[model samples]
Target: MTSPSDGTLVAEPRTDAWEFGDFAYGLEPLTMPPVGDATVSSALVPSALPPCNPDLVLFRLRLLAEGGTPDLPDTFTDPTDDQLFWFRWITGHQISFLIWHLMGEILERNTDREIPDRASLARLETYAYGYCAMLLYTGSCPIDLYQSLIRPRMYLQHRSFSGTWASDFVPVRGLFRGRGVARGDAPEAAGLARAVDVHKTIHDGIAARLVPEGRSLLQQTMKETVVRPSERTAILYDNFFMTLRAPVDGEGITSQLLRRLDAVASDVAARGLYPLGYGGDERPKELRSAEVAHCENRIGHLLHEVGEAAATPAKPLS
Candidate 1:
């Protein structure tokens, strides 16, 4: 994880990690030609449409096409820390992880209409490993218990919560369920149904929105609780999007962007938070504390270059 004083990342050859070069040209194309209803054989003529925001139409099309083969970020070279964080965050929010979890749940419950994509079934195990790593990093409850408590709670939250994107999909979901009624004959109805499934799959796999116990512990512990002599509390604000907008370089922005997480983890430990029975500890109390300490150390070492890297976008690769 150590980098030169100039803040240039060592750029270790990684067999298991994704390099920046891999995704250099992988962004989904933004422009989409006018599309007709899924059932319509003909494409819609753009000019024939009434005056409306063409930008919005393009945006929706782009959003639908955003899902590509998921891969780790280029900066994920160090296994000790970067991979841990990447794995944790991906399983918690990534679409790949969500769909996989939902399919597994449906199979386990032996629900009807359980159409399994045997080809993609392996992704479930991959995400499960990441999910387990996330639990360990966040010091959350045991995997099974966390799933039991979190899934149903999140399912309800997805329906009722208005602030999140999940809530916006509720109408579409209802439309899907009632497709046999008014829209049954529409050509696009099947596409709408698939969209509904994708929407629910993502909502069901959210690990960030935990059960009451997990949420309470995380919220309380993540606050600026550890007041330093300088009166600074350990708080790691999410600057990910902003950091993304900023220029990136070969030196790697993660070295500076996520540096605060170390302090946050330290603060959580210093406040004696490890032994709390929030999600139920599978390991002995001592081992749990040790793991927390280890997680924090790994986070600290992750992308730990000697110099500070400015938030900047990288130039196009030659």
Candidate 2:
């Protein structure tokens, strides 16, 4: 097994890796797409989207069925450190593909069906945290690269492509705003509420660091009209993450989520989250530490908590 000590992450299979099919009822991959590939980025085009968000859990299942390999950049085994830097950012977005849709499922069930037990909600929280962790990795890209390449590509999608306009997430905005069924007799609800707030906070911090000018996305885009949440915006969000839309079973969603989660955990463990190192001086003081060691430590900690929450929710998080 290739330990993380040397930081040469060729990626070996983990012995303790979990098979989500055995316990598919619960929980998330790590890879990047080919650079400058117009074909894979079709989610940004209005003509490419479905009338509504496709069941993302199904999309994941389809990927697994096709040999469990998601899209990849031209080079995987070896790339210059500079190229790997951007690869991490792209991989971060790729992993986030599942996190966004899974949260929507949790919110829908809370409002429409029997309230979920704490364990289930807690497991859901791990996915939410995984989303936050993805945001962190995205910001790991240097500001110069982000502005020169990443920001411009996003502009091609929409002038004001804000997170608030994700169609599936629009109905649940109150939860992040502290107006949802967070408290009352449901402690799990409150925990989820907290996770949402944290996710937003981290998002804001990342934006500030990456775009220190403090310009709103709208301001940056130089557009005044706020795009409403609809199929358009939903597709735009998925396009940014390069998620594919496909139909799959509702019950299969849980199994697929768990499968995706294990793949990501195994991949990151084998190759530390920010293998090149935390973008030094670019990272925020509150989160950056030990140069590179801090982020590697954090990656292990966050994923471990998420895995524990999904695999053994009966136990308390450490």
Query: How high is each candidate's TM-score?
Result: 0.23, 0.59
Question: Residue 183 of candidate 2: its Cα lDDT?
Answer: 35
Q: The CA-based lDDT of model 2 is what?
A: 0.50
| Cα deviation of 110, candidate 2, in Å | 2.7
Q: Let me know the TM-score candidate 2 reaches against the reference structure.
A: 0.59
* Cα-lDDT of candidate 1: 0.28
Misplaced by over 4 Å in model 1 are 1-17, 21-78, 87-185, 205-238, 242-318
Clashing pairs for model 1 are 246-312, 246-313, 247-312, 247-313, 248-312, 248-313, 248-314
- Model 2: runs farther than 4 Å from truth? 1-76, 80-87, 112-116, 183-190, 222-226, 250-263, 279-282, 285-298, 304-318
Residue 63 CA error for candidate 1 (Å)? 24
Query: All candidates' lDDT scores?
Result: 0.28, 0.50
Best by TM-score: 2
Give per-residue CA lDDT, model 2, range 1-318, as digits (tens).
Answer: 244676543333322223321221112121122111112322322121111112432343334333354333233344444454454555455545445445555665556534566655776667766667777666666677678777776677777866554443444455455554543346547766666666666777677777889885766655567555566666566566545444433333333344454445544544455555555675665344342233334654554454334333243222
